[model samples]
Target: MRGDVLVVHETEKPPESWAAAVLLTEHPDPSADAPPWQEEAIRLLRDRWAGPGRLVVFAGGRRGFPSAAPEHAEGWASDWRGTALAHSDVVICRSPGGGCPAGVAGWGAGHDSGRIVLRVPARPAAGERPEPGGPEVADAVTAALAHLGTGAERTGVQRQVPLPIWRTDSFQRWYGAQRAAGNTLLAARPVWSLRIGADRRLVFYWALHAVVHVTAEDRVKDNEVVISRPDIATAVLYVPGATIDDTEIVLVREFRTAASTPDGFVHELPGGSSMRTTDPRSLVACEVREETGLHLDPGRFRAHGSRQLTAPMSAHHAHLFSAEITPEELEVIRGLADVPQGVAAESERTWPEIATFRRIRTERLVDWATLGLIVQALTDRGHPLP
Candidate 1:
């Protein structure tokens, strides 16, 4: 995103009451000493804001940058030396009175694009200060962009909750791939989008808003936002014994906040998102090993089928698979119940759970969907039970 920047001084008065503003094309010498506020502004300009757009500074009375005099003018001038306001697409400034000043509405009068006023704390300790280049500022800028319908094709209303900014490259790459595959409902442009949550290197949840062109004469506004996530790979590890009572299904017990169970833990098949591997079979095997600490070949995983977990809320599917194991392998997996498994860096922890097939099928210890997967895998493998 090409971001325009406006640096405003801390004023008790509102923005419209300001008498002068200055447009700066060149940054002041880095070696020159500056006051605290100027120092913070310079940091934001250098690290946070990106521009081929205008850089404007605003203040009241005679106050201005140390190197430049205030251009006493009405509203924002169209020109200051060689700099022009016409090139600006967005305006960004800090909230000097703890909240955005009401007069900021006047600043938006001349521009069709969005304006963002970063919030500041009402009272900070004598030495403590908020980081202008931190995640909070990034969130504010992205929210402003989404609300203003900034994207390849601005369509419909870009509805989105304030969320962490997706790394620009990541969002662009994903969007480009979707367009190339013609999977975005013949979208003309993005109305808005945001990443709801994510892992270290991947997004777990996402939302999008767009406009679709179904025909030459018809333009349909896509709903406010459509949410989705990456598909999951899951598998049931079956261990055979001499009788039905002895037979077991290997599962993992992990703390999932989304789980509605009593303990907020899910006791289900070993499965997870494709984080460590992109190959579906490999992902199944990888999740099994990470969650159960039981090594198994990817080739051992038999793909039964895949289905959408939630049709209305997400477009992602769950790829179902199963693996057969020897009784000795079951013992080895059982031994891992006391030992924590899963990717530690990602804050995951799981314990192996080996339950009798009969009990798991009748007791409702797991979700109905998981029970369905188990039954489907067993029946497909020619081990149908009564």
Candidate 2:
């Protein structure tokens, strides 16, 4: 639950300035009953900020903060929802123009008004104590730590591990951050932790569920809850050079702020979660273009494979595909820097924050699990591997 520690000064420094007057949160409608945690979170936030800026709070809309602030407090609006959540927060920057800093770490970004709106991540309290041992939960937690690699359970901010071309640093940082936050209700591979429950019942972000069965007697049999995600579309696209062995991968490298990494961008397949549950095949075309500007005919993609990720803690499945990148498309992707996922404003984008980094070598750092699938796709298609 970290933030940028925004300090607005009225031509001078004051002890009470950091205390925000208005606590802003999202609501589909202003009249809807507020979330149960809203009031409690505000109370906690007030204590942390420590100044009686304003007693009144509002719960709706994100873009109206300028008009909503009181005259006494000309600039007093910030989002502090992370404090109530169990996980540590990471920073994200939004870029609308060719050069916007809204998305870089340790840097301020400019908005349309040429003003910087910095939303910095809050660093988690380091060295959280180990959980009390329970035979069942302890066993599960131990196994998860092993799969996640060393220092995953170590406190006081674990050091960064060298990212494989197959993995993103964001995931690694997130894993450590989750452990630092110490909310390990359910743990397993793929999904080291379950942030939210089924249909978002337990939390408001991720979907966690269990295999359930209802018998004729009306008695229910419930299995452990696991993570669920929108149907995903995965593709291992590559451009074939003049020589048969000159195949270069069509990959994307993007910064994921959730990992709290300045350089955690990973070599990833050009894919994304579904916008709908229908044929995921339709997603490849849009995702590839938005992610890397690599246009592809979805119809040309062949079904490479599918697999369940994090079998124990998640029912999340990824549908994998393989397609050949045309020479014209490769030219477009080859000339670019990485994309960074930023604010709520640009998050709804098809490519959100992604950049093209087509692969000429497997030696480039990659996200392992994803790279494994990509290699499989190539192997199935008889594409030569280095």
Candidate 3:
């Protein structure tokens, strides 16, 4: 089996192939003891293999993949390898905000066709779980080979990260809508992805290495790993008053892990990602109700247009809206201040905060992005802040 791809499980004897050896593991924990075969496999790759060959070790995890950490160097796969392959250069596949079983790619030697290890996603798509001899395993191998370039195997595996969204209905819908709007895709490949939601897994955050043709002369290449959850609906909710000073602004204080605040909490307007809904107004309305317990009418929301939240790193856009509430509604929202709220399954904890518009700006309570949304909403409504 000189040029053939060999797939083996635990304690399986090698088929004497030099092209590519894929070692599959049903063991989920990266901290678990490595089986006897793992050390032997690493030793063979380090000692033998003069020319083109590759070794791919694949494992699965239920809570998350070994390579889904914020920093790839700190990923579980980097230190999981036994003493034999301990110092090998590890490449954690970019899964922004982590995944429930992410993947990593590492090379043992200097050459491209060297020993590699991968942690395949236990849940590849919505409502799917990893099974022995499943198609996801094959997809994982294909992705590894693809990432390894032309030297991994001569089996004609395409030299691109396979789009693994075939079973993801939400991704399919988003892709279809994007394409229908004439944003022609030139060449796209998924780098890493994480599924969101408890009831069903959907591609929530994704990283991609892609090239898309936008216009006749505009071919954009994006290698950023921040490629998921592009469209989000947010609003500048307030109660209109005689002057901006008396205007009451509504914000939710929530613990954001990445926040630099002393309490790891950020105070921002009510907003959320466009999940399970296509209408921006509907999405914001639901988010407002869930976050602040203010059940405002969807018709009350006025679209203030949208802007890219982070253009350089991601395609995510903040769909801006503004809603003016009555004094009675303001009193109702104030009654719920400091109340623990948000979707429990998602581990979201928010406290509704009602502050004067002047106080918010004077104290610099919100980030620049939130400030921009406020300015945009006020400007759009012809009540530009002085």
Candidate 4:
């Protein structure tokens, strides 16, 4: 992995400055009674910083001087002096407890400083463990070099693609034209559907479930649509006393891949697309039961209201509802688990264990998913806004 280097400045140079590099290399055959710290330090350097460097081992009273053979010590160097030396624009000294001489003669060789000494904790601590890869060490080095004014910082930008929408009639016409044109525009045929609204507005949503390869100047090419504006529906469920505590709400966390969204894990409320049912209240109940094992009665939960979100490239109409649920109901919902089946079988063959469950307080309800719907339901019932 690529990373930056760190440089340190010192006012005065110590006696020994001739060593080009000081590396921690493992002993050919370390004794069982060897000091644990020495062994650990050598291990850390070898495992984490094995890239483009040489190893140097100091001699001890009993161990004598390290066997710096011609092949091993040809390009390697070390100082027995305790004095500080400058390398790669940074100062370094022999660590404490080594058998090297106190001060020794060394030259200021023009050497590139590509190595760093890391202080590792002697014992393991809570929430702390040895890093698995060298990238982490590279990151640390880069950060240190940046702080020392010897490294440059990098910047990156991400773009999101917007979903497309059209009228049902216009979409059908476009689909027929493309089909008659020998389907040359798209690699695979596009799937078109009619999304009708209660207000008599017919929206045509095209979903190309199959992948399509398009040759265009713009990098942001449109992918197949999984959910259309008309097919997209949202419902909010409310429990009267649920918000009393600060950690009651249980939001589902999953990985979602949609236009204008990250491909990482996301937290969302239980909801579905293309709801054919007329009763929004019943839809909320069914969704809650299906996604989260919580059985909610339609009569107990009432539709607060509906909101329509429209942008230049995407539109979604959501229906929000609220219902009261007991602590026992919350427990059941938290415990209910399922292993993904069918197409998702390989992805989640083993059921995911619940990571955590918390009841959120009324004042903190804003942190929960579908906060707008929850607020709407509460406000409709004369609940004062926070």
**TM-scores, each model vs. reference:** 0.53, 0.40, 0.55, 0.35
In model 3, residue pairs whose N, Cα or C atoms come closer than 3 Å (at least 3 residues apart or on different chains), thus clashing, are 64-101, 65-101, 65-102
**Tens-digit per-residue lDDT, 227-279, candidate 3:** 54537899888877677766788899998877887567899999997556478
Backbone clashes under 3 angstroms, per model: 2, 20, 3, 18
1 or 2, greater by lDDT? 1
lDDT of each: 0.54, 0.39, 0.54, 0.36
Model 1 lDDT tens row, 1-386: 55444454322111221111222111211112223443444445435444443233432223343323334333224332211221122333434344444333333321221122344333444798845345544554444344333222222111111112122333344445445755444322222332222412233555544444434445554664445556789998988655544568998999987899977899989998853338789999889989998899999999988886665665567899998898889999988889999988878999999998788867777987788888788878777577
Q: In candidate 1, residue 230 scores what lDDT?
A: 64
Scored against the true structure, residue 269 in model 1 reaches a CA lDDT of 90
lDDT of 4: 0.36
Please identify model 3 stretches exceeding 4 Å from their true place. Answer: 1-189, 197-200, 211-226
Worst 10 residues of 3 by lDDT: 105-114
> Of models 2 and 4, which has the larger TM-score?
2
For residues 1-386, could you state the per-residue lDDT of candidate 2 as single tens digits?
32212321122111221212222222212223333233333334333432223222333223222222232321222322221111112111212221324233222211221111222122223676422222322332233222222211212111111111002222433344444654332322121222232321121123222223333344443455444445567787776554434556766655565533336655567787642345768876666666766667889888865676555654456788888767666666665444432223545322222222234233545655676776677778775655
Any residue pairs clashing in model 1, and if so which? 153-189, 153-190
lDDT by residue for model 4 (180-271), tens: 74442322222433334452123345343322233333232346443334433344443344233232344555555541334354445565
Candidate order (TM-score): 3, 1, 2, 4
Candidate 2 achieves a global lDDT of 0.39
Q: What's the lDDT for residue 293 in model 1?
A: 88
